[model samples]
Target: LPSAGSSRFAAAVTQHAPAFKGTAVVNGEFKELSLDDFKGKYLVLFFYPLDFTFVCPTEIVAFSNKANEFRDVNCEVVAVSVDSHFSHLAWINTPRKSGGLGKMNIPVLSDLTKQISRDYGVLLEGPGIALR
Candidate 1:
């Protein structure tokens, strides 16, 4: 496994295998998406701790608020977490007033198996979670 300090890892991964195809949840719906889907378009791929949490919403909303800015730059935003697709839908359906993500215009990939997180070297082994 690569160390968290390996900044070169991301570059290496992107260089060797830049695109990944997978199933993700968007607007409370399950759909298939791929890195190729954003090809020819810049992207903002972010990771968060969990769905209904403190810092998570602040960042999610902040990104959502500025999503158009990213799009203006010909970019798309994709978020990820260890939660399942069901959990993602639940969060999306939840109201922001109750600490949920509300309706987001971006795809939130569910790394349920944690393989993606591990391959990216961001997985927190002890807790079976990933560091955002």
Candidate 2:
């Protein structure tokens, strides 16, 4: 999956973003997150290749660190990957020194079944991983 019609990073083709709801790790705990939960607000949704990777950690950390700034602008940042929530939590627990996302402020949704990634048009059929 690359994008529904023309969604790119912060731009778009359609006004409506794909609908999704799933288990997400928020503040070190598992919680249900959905597009409806952020209804009426600008959403900054990004999909990374996977957790525990080089660029992935940097991207997640950057988004997490800027969560407040995003909130001030009435936007909620969300990161999604094909990994499970448990994998996300483990990666979050791992320190940056060890090449993992120390912690994340935003909800990290798990697209374990790859459905979410597909919906977002970022899943690679061959590798079964989402593109960043």
Candidate 3:
């Protein structure tokens, strides 16, 4: 992957994906994940502003519901948010009726420090939030 500061990235609309590493909630457990973990596999990664909000749960569940389809094509679906791991766990534990993304099969990473959002160039500096 090209470095975030590389000229290629500056000139190209779609540069190499930024690298990230952090803790994530997976099947009710916390796990560590990094870009390297998906080195040999195709990944469908999504970054949402936060959890338990309007539209976010729907998107998360949508991707999660079709997890099998991605696996069939050798791809892994992963999500990231600025919320903490604890928040992720709670949301997943809650049911869809409560507007929570319950029991997702994919990894939902926490970018509590916002480093991942910054590296991905999706961080809204002024608001200290990530744009989906």
Query: Mind giving the per-residue lDDT tens digits that candidate 1 earns over 30-86?
Result: 998877788788777777777777888888878887888899889899887888888
Tell me the lDDT of candidate 2.
0.85
lDDT of each: 0.76, 0.85, 0.85
Q: Give me the displacement of residue 103 in model 2, in angstroms.
A: 2.2
Per-model C-alpha RMSD: 3.6, 3.4, 2.9
TM-score to native of every candidate shown? 0.83, 0.89, 0.88
The clash tally of candidate 3 reads 0
- Tell me the number of clashing residue pairs for each predicted model: 0, 4, 0
Error at 71, model 3, angstroms: 0.8
Off by more than 4 A, model 2: 1-11
1-132 in candidate 3: lDDT tens per residue?
557743223213566567778999988999999989998888887889988897899988999999999999999999988999999999999999988887898999999998887777677778777778
Q: What is candidate 2's CA lDDT for residue 63?
A: 91
Model 1 RMSD, rounded to 1 decimal: 3.6
The lDDT, on a scale of 0 to 1, for candidate 1 is 0.76
